[model samples]
Target: MTGNPTSRDYNKASVLDVLLSRAPLTRIELIELTGFSKSTVSRAVEELRADGCVVNGGVDEVTGRGRRSTYLDVPGTMGHVVGISFGMRTTCVLVADLRGRELRHVIVPTVDHQEVRNAAEWLVGLMAEASKSAEGPLRQVVVAVPGRVLGGTEIFGPAESMKVFAGPGLQRALADLVNAPVLLDSDANASLLEILTDDATLEDAALFSMSSSLSFASCIDRELLRRRTPAFGDIGVLFSGVGNEVLDGLLSTSGLLRFARGRGLDLERIDDLWLHPHEEVSRADVLDAFTTAMVTAVSAVAVTLDPGSVFFVGRLRPLVDEVLPEVRRRLDKSLATAPEVKAPTQVLGLSVARGAVYACLGMARDRLRDAVLEARRQGQHTEQSAPAF
Candidate 1:
């Protein structure tokens, strides 16, 4: 309480961190997990409880020697966070509490207008509607976009449908509307964040997204590599080695649809390529082309980064299974060693939103911690400044 406000009270912060990460723990468990002395743990817990940051989660069922140890947890009343996955056609929005529990989730068709203001209004409306179900105030918002994010504020080199989110206008508009800090990141990065959350053991891995956009994100040594300006992970620009076409124009859902249509398959939806019956020869040709392009792209990533695993996500995930065996066979034949290639267990849209929620939850926790520290500092100052009675 007497320490500098700018500096972290390690004991207090450690106690809160553990509770947030692995909660429902008894005081003894907290001391054991944080390696803090009994008195320090008790003091920290008391302060957190006083600040309404931590709450008693009732007593543990298992009885100890003297009394049943009480479980401690971070209260859901801390605040809520919103995660938005802004896609070309459909946008997914998720609201989660401080404990990262989903409160509400909705998928709505994206606005057709190219106006950034209109798009922002649409998104804000969706967020406000979803936030109604939240148990607390909104603390943070993270938006996942299918484009290059520059400086966490602007979208660059976005697809034509996503042009409405380009520049700083959308980010600024959302911040003003939501009254909370907004984080803009590529959908690929958002997917990677979700993957990391699900599997903490992943050190060197790559996620390839073949949805509306063709991009990938990588984790090296358990750290995600991001850039202030757009670079890397733009696999869409890589040549497909099939004439003058890039993977972006060859492997993306849109690109695949275009190719199928051009081949006289009359494919309207991506699902139609596989689900709808087309000329067997034409369908085979299209699938073969897709398989080749995907193999080339995945090989490029595997060979360059040597990632331990490569996960296929996005709209094309369904088709990936059909081509994966062939893709793997080709990769094994082409490279001395090939990383494990498989589809992620979660759906692409949900994965992106969930990942963004994870980021939002982290930011919200930091804000809460800082607020608690500041409040304590102010209380201490008030006590010191009070005239002696």
Candidate 2:
């Protein structure tokens, strides 16, 4: 007769889940936390250890106890996950262990001219370089792009500079090169993942990436609202109240530069637009237009979603300090309820990569748990098939 599937598998999974959440715990603590008997916890830990999923940590010091307890933890040597933020200006890559501890972080300028295959090769090289310290093979990779992701395998509507990634080819290439599963998602969605990680209580929140392109993502009831449709979250195309200009044409970094140039300001960089002589009337005019467009976009999102909070991220983060007050003031004047608007604490590019890591951690955990259970079952089969001693 077949044994109950949940008998041992469920115990092992529960123990692993606890260690993943709170590691370096003792056997006594595991027994107490899981409400399982000592034998059950011991069996689970032994099986996990045999499968290389768990390892012994330091011994806990005892005050006046009979013995010292050895702490058990999910081993970092089990494997690692990679998070990549492929942006127009720069790409950020982060390597983290199954426990969510960062092992490597790198930021490099993006080559805008590379084709999909070339870009995949270049990124694989970077991933290999970043994961040198990882003791085991790569388990999962999540790539963040400034575009719409369909079914986590295809890319669409990427920004102009990153148009090379707009298709399923890049994801397929990366999966082939890395010999591991790969997932693609919008950079804005990745940012929202990072935010949700910081504060799990947040149910409804929106994020706006005001960089080379204007992108948006939202979390409703603690879940990211993802769609397979093309241009699903491209808030940049929303019509700005100003003379047929879309929000992207007026509020994005490129849009801001174009507006400044139209005002006769010879600005070569975004920094220059903000650092121009305070006495220049044209610079002030550009700021006014930028703030007006921001207020309009934010008010629309606030009224529609009624999110509890709104976040501004990416290249325009520096301008938040100057423009936020006006945004809030204008929203207060027009809307009955305005979401709390602010900038995230982490840098734009790194946050995208970190969020990708958060997005893949669950998958990695599931893979680990299944491997442990399978190893146990195989061992049992081998024993049953052996002749009696």
Candidate 3:
């Protein structure tokens, strides 16, 4: 109701921030940590509890008076968030709680040219299914796109199906379906967030997603560095110095499959290329070609960002072990200093989805905190206007 925040506003925000960051605290602990009076902490916690932002945890051990004190926490069940990652050939849907704990994760096949509306419809169903078992109502949604997102809505990329979900209209469509605000993030950026959230040791890193297409996301000092355009690290757009062809046209799985087809190989996809043996084009040869193409891309990134580590995700995970040594070798030759290059050992397929979940969880927490403050403010105003009888 006020144009500017008051001391009370700052207090509420502080309490919520502390509890959300380091939770499962008893009233006494919250008072000590927040430096607010016990009554202020109690009132703040009560407001948050009423707003479903905080919940009562199990009772703490008996105190000096032989009375057990109940601990309070920002329960994961208080709210739910969804993260969706769209690939050229597949889409991953993830549902998680306020605490960023994964509840459901599912991967579905997608057509490269599905209508934008059709893609959104498919995502709605997938999101519902993923959140079916979650404890609370969904609070926020984040969609990680594989292309350039201009002005926050217009997405330009080769993924034809995503055109529908490109701009503000996409957010409205998704928000209406899930009854929650939707966020859009680059898939590579989401992957970068996932790596940072999982590994605290990484202050700066580069994440390269190699699928039918290639994208790069970088982070510095635990923050996503902004690019000139929405899609900054799309390696696919770069010319590979080989004729007039782009890197995506030269090195992506789709490109390799085309090469296989041209060579009279029976491989229909990259996965098929490995499963079935071709007399003329061996898997070794295909891998060797991929390594060569990736060497150039990796070198470019290492020399530019000079990140602390380089991670390969997506379809490239299966080949990371073999690819790591080769890329490292190439980088060692090209750059004065090469970062640590390796493949993620876990969350291989769901990194982008996990990042989305984390992003949505953060949004949900902020929203819930604001709601708690508003409720408290309204309650105080009501008390102040009450007539003295």
The candidate with the higher lDDT, 2 or 3, is: 2
Put down candidate 2 lDDT per residue, 1-389, tens digits, no spaces. 33333566778778887887678899999999999999999987886676566899899887985888899987877778999998889899899988888999889998765678889898888888888888676889999988778889888777677777778989998988986789998888899999999897899999888777788899899899987587677777887776677888876788877877888888888778666554478877777777778887888788778899998888877777688898889888888888888887778679999999988887887776665446445554312332010
Tens digit of lDDT per residue, candidate 3, span 1-389? 43444566567678887887677888888999999998888776765665556788799876468778888888765768889887766788998777666788988786554355666777898888888888767788888877655544556564433455555666556666767777777777788888888788899888777665666778889888776575566678876554455667656567667765655677766777656556754556656666766676767777788788887777756766766787678778877887888788645447788888888877777776565456445554412331110
Which of 1 and 2 is the better model by TM-score?
1
Q: Per-residue lDDT for 184-221 in model 1, tens only? A: 98888889889888887888988877777787788899
Error of 3 at 333 (Å): 2.4
RMSD of 1: 3.5
Look at candidate 3 and tell me the lDDT of residue 207.
78
Q: Clashing residue pairs in candidate 2, if any?
A: none
lDDT of 2 at 370: 69
Candidate 2 local Cα displacement, residue 53, angstroms:
0.9
lDDT of 1 at 205: 88
- Off-target runs (Cα >4 Å) in candidate 3 are 1-3, 27-40, 60-69, 75-77, 111-113, 135-137, 160-169, 228-231, 241-245, 262-265, 276-285, 346-349, 372-389
lDDT-sorted candidate list, best first = 2, 1, 3
